[model samples]
Target: MSFARNFIGLGGLLSLAAQAQGAYTIQDTYDATNFFDGFEFFNYPDPTLGFVQYVDAVTANATGLAGYANDGIYLGVDYETQNPAAGRASVRLVSKQSYTRGLIITDIAHMPAPVCGSWPAFWTVGPNWPHSGEIDIIEGVNLQDSTSVTLHTASGCSFSQDSWSPQDCGTPGDGSQGCGASTDNTQTFGAGFNEIGGGVYALQWTSDALRVFFFPRGSVPADIDAGNPDPSTWGNPTASFSGGNCDIDSNFANHQIIFDTTFCGVWAGRVFGDDPTCAAKATSCEEYVGNNPADFQDVYWLVNYVKVFGEDGGFKRSIAKPFNA
Candidate 1:
């Protein structure tokens, strides 16, 4: 279950209506004060082969690609000039500390607009990738209007759902399309999300299962803002993956929180022509994403905060650097 997708986005809403898991204490918060320091800028090539340039921390902050706006962390991309070399300039952040199981709550003010040639996500991944595991808390490609929560893992790692589940966690078709479900609520992503001033996306990962929930701005649970989160009161999750046939412990290890906006790649680019809007813009996805630079002016992330709540701070991933150099 990698980055690729069919892009249909709409699926049945199978809910379990389980109870609130439990209360959680905040262990870490990433807001303007410590956002940059808490995460490392991925200055490497796009692993998905997207049309993007992952810049370093110095360049991102100094060049205005990453900064703070109204006390919110702002991560944006270049929107000037046409078709530059090395793809569009963007930012990808990986949390310095990783966790095994925890409740992550992200309060977003705005996400990238629902525009063609853009793929954005707020997710988590184990250090070793496929063999480890990946949970897509919020993700979509092209002009998708809502969120798609999915799980990707190595072979023989599959999970069950309340109603009916997708296939195993391994790749089903040509590539990995990890079993997942969509929120189908327009207010949960893209333009609609920004119009309502964005809200909260919470990911609850426990040994028994992984669940994702979305609360629109005015509808966020009171407990969340009060520093106490009770998932049981949040109603059915937008997407839930049961640990039935999967080995949650062995398949998922210390995972780092991630947020990024990438263009035409394995997912978006592969199905470029499949999307009428994007296809009509240009013959290829790269051409439009590269030449129509102004089209991406609104491609950005406005985060109020990201709080991780867990006992023992969840499973901490050991690393040499306490902070990103």
Candidate 2:
């Protein structure tokens, strides 16, 4: 349980003033050995009821669906199984700890490619589904080269056109499509992401707003590498979700981080008709995924580290208090 405390001073008065505003301090880190300990394998049926089998840690390790590799966490899907009955076997993990407000930074070395019938995501969700809200930080389906960030909540949440697709953060039946922001950079997702050797993804959640930023491998800031991240100095985020219409505090709470890769269920299956490339492969997402086992050979996640930070240098180490109040 060693902590890295490296604070940079900006000269006398300014440094003191900066401290008054609050600074990000490292709270918890999950890597290789510790990463598996921090998260629990999700063996239950997928919430979306996707055509996939979520295996436990024992099965994951035995089947080579999950393990440690190159000093990082490796989570992959079954590539050897041919046309199976249930579905393609995969791994889904959810953090045992939950956070209310903090900065979550994930450094990934590789991610699953945007192959047909494949859907991968690194996101967070609170207890009780739509009532507590869900944040789709990195999510895309089929052959999408760019990542799409979305926020889903109950009624009465809305956002301006700040993102690429500014939709209401409310239920679809309520006339809102949910707040969605698609990244313009191709290197931010899929095969392009792995081509650049992956990178760091930082998500800052506060009472005011939720911001997400992506820094490609070579471009990651030195401060992050030093374990002294300062989001203020990181410049504009790739996606910013904030406005007077949305009540940030009420809409989001006690969210647990999650990582999973599933074959076409709701999103990918529903939109299978739209993707020409994917549609040409098979009549449906499940059909394509069930038959073409080799297509997902490169589908996996290689994570270097996941670090959590709190504001004002206030971080609690107790597992009981996963988040700072």
Q: Write the per-residue lDDT of candidate 2 for residues 214-284, one digit (tens) a residue.
A: 99999998888887788889988999887758888888887888899998988888898799998998998
| C-alpha lDDT values of all predictions | 0.78, 0.79
Name the 10 consecutive residues with the lowest summed lDDT in model 1: 1-10
Q: Model 1: per-residue lDDT, tens digit, 1-325? A: 0111111211222221223335565667788667776777887888889999988877877677787776677888888958978999999988877777878899998888867789899988875567778888888888888888878888777766662255877776322687777666998888899888889999888888788888999999998988779887889888888846788888888788899999989898998899898888899988998878888888888888898877443434343233221
Which regions of candidate 2 fall more than 4 Å away from where they truly are?
1-22, 164-166, 174-177, 313-325
**Candidate 2 residue pairs in backbone clash:** none
**Candidate 1 error regions (>4 Å):** 1-22, 172-175, 312-325
